[model samples]
Target: MRTLALPAPRRSRGRSAVFLAAAALLAGLAVAPAAHAGDGRKAEAATLHDLAEDHGRYFGSATDNPELTDTPYTELLGEEFGTITPGNSMKWDATEPQRGVFDFTKGDEVVDFARAHRQRVRGHTLLWHSQLPGWLTSGTWSADELRAILKNHVQTVVKHYKGKVFAWDVANEIMNEDGTYRENLFYKTLGPGYIADALRWAHQADPKAKLYLNDYNVEWIGPKSDAYYELIKQLKADGVPVHGFGLQGHLALQYGFPGNLQENLQRFADLRVDTALTEVDIRMVLPSDEAKLAEQADWYARVTEACLAVKRCVGITVWDYTDRYSWIPAFFEGEGAALPWDENLKAKPAYFAIRDALGVRPKKT
Candidate 1:
């Protein structure tokens, strides 16, 4: 039921990033940074991930198993990002499709790829309400039965990838937009204590791994974030193992950029918890024009700036690096072009914008 995903692997669209660049130029925009003769080799090769490291942060992207077949896509993904998340590979349905049985093949492929590429892996989720196995969702269970099932799943998954992953979104999207606990299977069966329990389980499974509570639409200051503020505060007071708050930066052009995003992240940092833009993507209406693309670039810059502005804002991860594998078209009608690179695997204005935000520049010849 994670409706936001419809990941079609390697369905590349469009032609000629040169055409994209020409259009951008005609619209009076500086295109993404490209290799130049006079540029130093190190600067020329430095990627977004490298630039982010200069700021002491990591730049990452989410990837799936199938997209690994795409040579060009995988090449850029591995080169430009320092971290990767298995978009759906690590979810409950994919990991443990049967009661008392676990499968880590899909998730392991991603981890292996990241390891080969020398990139760190972030375990996407140990528990979620959507994309659940039929048996678990269909079968009925009492509170105690459900609690044991939940605990086993969380700890087993966390331990399986124990030393490989540096972080785990122990629970995901467990809050309603209106700032109420989502009455998901766990919440309804085991009560809100499930979050604390899950976090503790993950911590026990891998003490070094960072544990996070992830949700979308909490980027800006609002009732939804207010709810998380109160929740995290109480969790800290109660000595829960909550370590980070993930703001899934899934934004739409029509909604306008989130207000006071830096201040919002700052407040969370003030709570002595780490913060990250877990899933960054900015989608726009279909038939995207130069203006829309430019606007998207501006938003990317702003988000990067906001994260850089905060000391504890650890890192940023695009939902994926390129629109070739983007989920926007499948999930949001008449909305696409949600990533820094277009479907052609060529960087766009947004890519350069992000680089500029990270303080990278092409030295003049």
Candidate 2:
């Protein structure tokens, strides 16, 4: 699971969003003259989630089932964020291990944890190309057969957690980096209509859950983001229930910052749908040094600032919030240290940067 989103700008944002930001700015200037540099003691007791809520947003992190048993890790996760996304529990393979029969055991653990912590849950995904159950992936099917299977999977999963989950990544990473459809199982079998149908089916299951199209590397305005912009506009025109767009802010230091980030988010806000950074983590080439860490911190702050600047951009969720269980080192060898917390759970420069970006300044002792 991951968080994806874009950068700043209200750009004809809703009246309420504009008013809140303006009011917060005015109040910040009155209380702490150095507002950009530091926030006032009003937020001294605030966790990352608290600071986000101050601006009518949420701060969240992704967690997997195994880590839930680590009391220390779970403690911090429960305390720090207002929302959570299960890294793998809610995925296709985990939920429906066998055909028709479903298993909600792993996903339920996360939902229960979130309930106990008073946190909102964002369903990682209802559909994706990867991680399908062996039966579904191995079996052959015609368009009609596959469509029914897909509808069942999406509806059953969405209906099961109806009120518990606030949003659903109805379809994940359906686009290629170059802006073409991924031609995945759904795409090849059912054609491009699969996306619209998936969203529709998910909505039917849980009409209230925000349906989203989630993808990585769409943080900036380019071919990929452009495709989503146009597609979303079309969906809205066609009376689709698509509610949000998720920019999986999986960034690397080597790649320069997305110059048009804020502008990109602004454009989407202009479309009147919500936006979010779903699986945020800025990784660097490893054997990390102070310079690299500082750079990563800056990137985190930039991303936070970007989200804050946009009105419909609702929230941000770091992939796991810590490097100890980071998916980077294993997935991308020779690369690691992607999270704000160290292996031992120590706050790194990136952590302070995010807190500061969220407008919190610890009370000087």
Candidate 3:
């Protein structure tokens, strides 16, 4: 692959003052050339796979993170992978940080980038327990107020981004680890109907976008998995506009990857909704153990292969493109290097492995 010039990072506002500094630093780093000579556009065009971007603080472009540039994103685009999942760009807190007051600046920028590149946008998480503002959980508002607030929030954000976004993780991580329904403020206040209502409202707001129910750990076919299966079945039976399922394949090299991921994904596809391998990344402990690195590569290949084999599995999205910007280290102490690319923007063995799995020859440009 030939080398390409990196674009200067742009600035974006965050909910907190601390993120402003972090975003600035990211912007600066984004423009520096991360690729070697003769490896810019030519090499990237050769080896690039059409995969989706995992949106988060690290994956945010140079503008959003001063240290990084839009070159990587453009490289990915050149590779023919045009879909992106806003890691957290459209989350409840980010979009509606202060209740009725909605913010679409960051999310819009991402959408605009996707549009400029002719890429598809996945609107992540219309509903989730984490990253929610404190005001919603204080239990201070009446039920009617809460319902009005929730309805307004969904309608406003969805309508604002209508047509630009192709799909949405309408509800995320609603089930608990123990296979029971998690008690989120919306559920506690609005009851089970809220799930259906949220979906209904989202469908009404943007009828074109595909709405999905996203969750982690459903890769396995055990009790927790059973709970999700039944929940979706019920939702479908109730005639909800739920169109897809997002399986977050956050794998670890130490523990074995889920035994029957293909079969599990197939079962969901049998329900007639598309499935996606969302937020995929295999983590390894630091110090760069070769054995673990090899294992991680193998895991990436297998997951990519599985997605390809599953006809309904639209695409696979890595949580981050490179290790330098991975959320694993900060979120999971001592864990690092959780992506197909290394921090220096070099392809790891996993990159080739994924290409092999996708049955695409590396470009010789």
Backbone clashes under 3 angstroms, per model: 1, 13, 34
**Per-residue accuracy of model 2 over 126-221 as CA lDDT, tens digit each:** 899989989998999999999999999999999999999999998999887678998898888889899999999999999999999999889888
Flag the better candidate by TM-score, 2 or 3: 2
Q: For residues 97-194, write the lDDT of model 3, one tens digit per residue.
A: 78678888878877777677666778887888888877666658778998898889888988998988888888888877777887988888778788
Provide the RMSD of all predictions against the true structure, rounded to 1 decimal: 6.4, 8.1, 11.7
Ranked by TM-score, the better of candidates 1 and 2 is: 1
Please give each candidate's TM-score.
0.90, 0.88, 0.80
Best by TM-score: 1
Candidate 1 lDDT tens digits, 64-97: 9999999988878878889999999999999888
- Candidate achieving higher TM-score, 1 or 3: 1
Every candidate's lDDT: 0.84, 0.84, 0.68
For model 2, the superposed segments whose C-alpha errors exceed 4 Å read 1-41, 360-365
Off by over 4 Å in 3: 1-47, 50-80, 360-365
Candidate with maximal lDDT: 1
